[model samples]
Target: MKTSYVSNLAIQTAMRMTIQQNQMDLLKATQEQTTGRHYDVGLTLGATASRSLNLQREIDRLNSMKSTNSVVTQRLSGSQGALETMAKAAEKVRDTLVTYKGNDAASQLKIQKTEILGALQTFTAAANTSFNGEFLFSGINTDAKPLADYTATSAAKTAFDAAFTAFKTANSITSDDQITVTQMQDFIKNTVEPMFTGTGWDANWSDASSQNMTSRISASEVIESSTNANTNGFRMFAMASVITAELMDKNVTPEVRAAIGVEALQYVEQGIAGLNAERSQLGISESRVKKANTSIDAQLKLVNTHVADLEGIDPIETSTRINTLKVQLETSYTLTSRLQQMSLLNFL
Candidate 1:
């Protein structure tokens, strides 16, 4: 009787073990069929978990760069457009100055003044361009407007008035004889140049900032994200614009204004030249950003491939495994059922 009871207990224990194993197999097979991946990633890639984790980290970084690059690219494009606008306006100023200086009719002079003022406004507007309400040319001070308006009461006009007055006082004469080309040269060198060079110029006015903004486009690379209004080329453009307005003011004699007009041509040429230089620089930066974006995308793709290899299962193989597990489960259930039917009456 003791032996028979011991045999029954052993059969029950074995059946219990078989049922538990079958349940685990069914659970694994169900997961594989539903998800098409091995249910146990830790078991499959335990040896490479460290490497897989590292690659995942890199992938995360690349994704972050992609998000940031979207906005960076837009800012760069906006900057480039703003620069082109300003450069074209400078060209217009240069062309109009040629026309204005050539003809001295009161009607044409008045018309040219209107045109110059319009160009000045264009320059101001270009300098103050914003993307999403943030100033593009304000450098790090993106919240600040880059240039004040060109009205007579604005800071830029006030600086010009003060500098022009000082220039006239220093020369000690107001006649055409004292305001020849030689005098124009002297005035620019001693007056306007100083205003741009020394602390007096930037201190008194100059709304445009000298600050530059930079961005990290890649892990090891940083690039300038924007250009400022206070660059040398931009400064020269401002000088030419201011000179055009001054010449149009008719504050001096016709002959004096004409001579100064000739002198102003030099500034117009320099400003145009400066515009070209700045545009070239911006073009190079744009190219760098494009290349960096490409590199980032490529890295993400390669890293994701590595991650799949490390932890992912083949769909075909997982399907085969699910079938095998189902067959084993059916066999285990059949055997457990037979064992559960055993009894002492059958043994007698």
Candidate 2:
């Protein structure tokens, strides 16, 4: 009787130990399936979190770059349009000046002057053109006006209001001369140039020179003389000074007038070349922006892929693993239930 009791006690103890071991194994398997993380305490949580955060930061950086590129592209497109208008206006001025010189009649000359002045006013307005409320040609000083207002009777007004009105057939000239090439240039020099010294637009000026006419003209006397020579305020006085004195004199022969026309054409050609160069430079910048955007997009895609690898789980694989864990857990519970029914009498 004593031997049988001892045997039963030893068997019961062995059975309990086996059940406890199975329960612990089942718990570990369930945890693995539910969490998809291996049971390990040595894994570096800080390092994993830092890597994830870094990828997110990179994604944010690329997004910001894309936004900046879009703005620059828009600005560059508007600038291209403004440049085209400027080139067209400069060409028209040259043609009109040539035609005016060809005709010996003072009446015709006055008429041509009126037409040229009107064209100049139109060009000046265009030069002070804006994109999204910011002046396109005002360098980096978008807030400052590129052209100053010149009231018709103001001391600085050089062009005749009567002539401009006759040409336009409308009072679009208003009661003011509006603005002139010289004043506009001066405004750019003083306000716009400094802000753009090391920027893309700075290359438009000669050498490292400031856009200021005073610095560019060098000789104070010559600058003053050119300014005084401009009887019409809308005239580009510095450029106009290139025309020989012999060609400008009212008493000069028809031959001299022809010569002056040729010189004026040359000057116009030079101005066109300069504007074309600027347009080309803008084109290059636009191209660089496009390339940069493409590169940024590629980087963002790579980051996204890496992030998915880190955090995103495959649904099919996860489902399969969970089902396997459920089966194992159910089998362990069934075994534990059968063990509870076992006793010395059942064994006998």
Candidate 3:
């Protein structure tokens, strides 16, 4: 009887252990399929959650960079259009100066000069352009204005005005002398030329060497004299002066009149060339930004995929696992319950 009782008790205990073991196994399996925790659950969750947050932050950063790049690209396109227009205006000035057709030609030259000056002012304004209120062409100084106002009476313009005044004063000039033929020639060669070359007032301007302002003039000395008929300077400056002088003397000679017309055209043409070069550089920078955005996007996609793989559950696999575990646990419980009901007499 004792032997039968011991046998029944052993069966009951065995069934109870089986049920508990099955429950533990099911829990482990569920964790593996769903939560993916073969070891420490808390640590795994923390790591995965952290990684997800980091990936999301990276995506946001890339998106911001893309937005900035878009603004820069649009601005560059506008700059290119402005430069092309300036070039066309300059070409027209060149054509007028080459013809040298007396009063009619001089009149046309004056109109072209006005157009060229307007174009140059536009070009300078474009150089100081901003994207999202941030200056694009000021190099590392993104907040700094690339071009100071030439028309402003502020400290920024003082240096330029002072330099021009010095040259005029050196030539012994006041009022009318400040606007004389010789004075105009000197101002263009000394003041205007230096500003473009990034030597005088524009020395601190960004990308000075790359802009190639000085290279536009084939000969610096020839630009000052009216004798150099082959160079554009003789035609550009001399013609503008002649037109100004023509306001005083309508009988200005054909030779003097033609020279003035040509010089005005040449000056504007050079400005267009410089602006076009800057536009090209801006285009290259825009392309680089686009490439960077693409690269970052790719990286973000990769990280997100990794985070999903680490943390997310597969519903199909989890369901199958849960069903199997349920069956095992139920079988163990039934076996234990039957064993617990058994006695010595029943067992015999």
In order of appearance, the predictions have TM-scores of 0.79, 0.53, 0.48
Predicted candidate 3 versus true structure: per-residue lDDT over 1-348, tens digit per residue: 354323666667777777777788678667767555333434557746666667667767666755655555565555456445544544544554454445545476567445434543554464555555655454444566655443445343455467656765877766532355554555656665555444443443333212211111111111110011112221232223223322222333445434444445466555445445555654665566556556756876886677567656666776787798799888877777776666657768
lDDT of 2 by residue, 202-241 (tens): 2221121223111111111111100111111223321432
Model 1, range 200-220, lDDT digits (tens) per residue? 546544555677888898999
Best by lDDT: 1
Displacement of residue 337 (Cα, Å) in model 2 is 27
lDDT of each: 0.76, 0.51, 0.50
Report residue 237 deviation for candidate 3 (angstroms): 13
Error of 3 at 256 (Å): 3.8
Residue 36 accuracy (lDDT) in model 3: 51
Specify the poorest-scoring 10-residue window by lDDT in model 2: 222-231
